[model samples]
Target: MSFIALHPLRTFSDTWRHRYLLAQLIKRDVLLRYRGAVFGVLWIFLSPLFMLAVFAFVFGNIFQSRWPEQTGGMPFWLLLYCGLIAFNIFAETVSRAPTSVRGYPSFVKKIIFPVHILPVVPVGVALVHGTFNFLVLLAALSWSGNFHAHALLFPLLLLPLLLLALGISWFVAAWGVYIKDMTQIVPMLVQMLMFVSPVFYPASAVPAALRPFYDYNPLGTVIESTRSAVTGQSIDWRAWGVALGFCMAACMLGYAFFQHSRDEFADAL
Candidate 1:
């Protein structure tokens, strides 16, 4: 009897069976980030700490802005650090997504690879750095005497930001293969988002008329909710619900876009 060829479904099953390759690729991405750095992985922890110091020095002291009172005794630095951690994860994941697929042309050209897994590498690397940053935030808050029981909920609050990043990453990574300019554009967009999102200043500082804009942006609400969770403060559940809904929609749309464009990647590369 003639042997039957494997069906398309079996090809997908074979790809799923290669999940270990994806894990190794993610590990490689993480290690390659610090390959030549003197401090290696230590740089992950120190970079954000140094960032907080500069921000605190400039905004906390240079401008002498009064820290808002709603943080329930949490130091302004701690409040800023909480928001910083969440924003860093979002920024790092989205910024690097463009390069994730673009950087590995060999895999696309030569190997029988599952390209969809490519965008995941940056998110995995960012999560590793984020875990370290979270530990550092914990230590800082504990030292500042602002560590609350709610700090344990910080991970839960960050889920929305992670979802947002994943969605943006998939969309950017796919487009990056087609258009080279995304590499430059994504970072600039993230910088704009940082300023727009409540990283250096609280949403409370924004005028009421302008508050609606911040409420609608997923990044702002995620950052604010993350800060509140870490410090045992209250959050606007209505805004959060709206932001989370957008995040879920982004994730679905991004996945759809990525899957549709994925077949074109090898040709684009």
Candidate 2:
């Protein structure tokens, strides 16, 4: 008898090996999200603009908030939007991961599909949303006269966060199949995480003792660095390096776990 070996490296290569299929899945996922809306795909562009308007009204006009040490005269809402873009990418991807696998029984029981790739669909969809949000941020910065060449680095700065989200998605998607309640629980945790991360607030706003925790958080570090990229401030390369290392490890481990647990998926469902 002959058997195939599934290594951690194979997890990544398989995605690449089936890149076309993955793209189709991602495209289908994005279309399905806004399928019934009157605006259709236009929501992808309008949704972020609406959120930015809300943030401007609440934080800019209502609260009149400001960063502890504002950079380059950037408005409070623009600053908040930068961090929110990064956090939203992570939040949206992870919150939907549980449903990615559980919601599609045909992919698992009735077809010869790469079940692992299903978790990636959410991350891809979130990236599409985040890209639109980033463009809106650039337009706001340009209108406010805060746009900079460094803003181009925003996409590169978010690479680590993307990896981390992909990792978490794989883990949660696997568990969600066996434990149905995970779908309900993950969104709450993600909402809590948004507050804990440096989205609405800056790390400087945190107490001195708790500063170290923010310093070590991958999401926080990514948010801070992404903001820096947008505001043309000096990025903390050392911190980004640490986050990159952690996210790489997480990606590998999550893929391994998913592959291991997937064997029981058919039986679980």
- Among these predictions, the greatest lDDT belongs to 2
lDDT of 2 by residue, 21-48 (tens): 8899999988988999999999999999
Task: Note the residue pairs that clash in candidate 2.
Answer: none
lDDT of each: 0.78, 0.89
- The per-candidate count of clashes, in order, stands at 0, 0
Alpha-carbon lDDT of model 2? 0.89
TM-score of each: 0.85, 0.94
Local accuracy of candidate 1 as per-residue lDDT tens digits, 90-191: 999999889888898888776567777788777778888888888888877777677888787777777778778977888899999988999999999999
Q: Relative to the unseen true structure, what is the C-alpha lDDT of residue 261 in candidate 2, on a scale of 0 to 100? A: 85
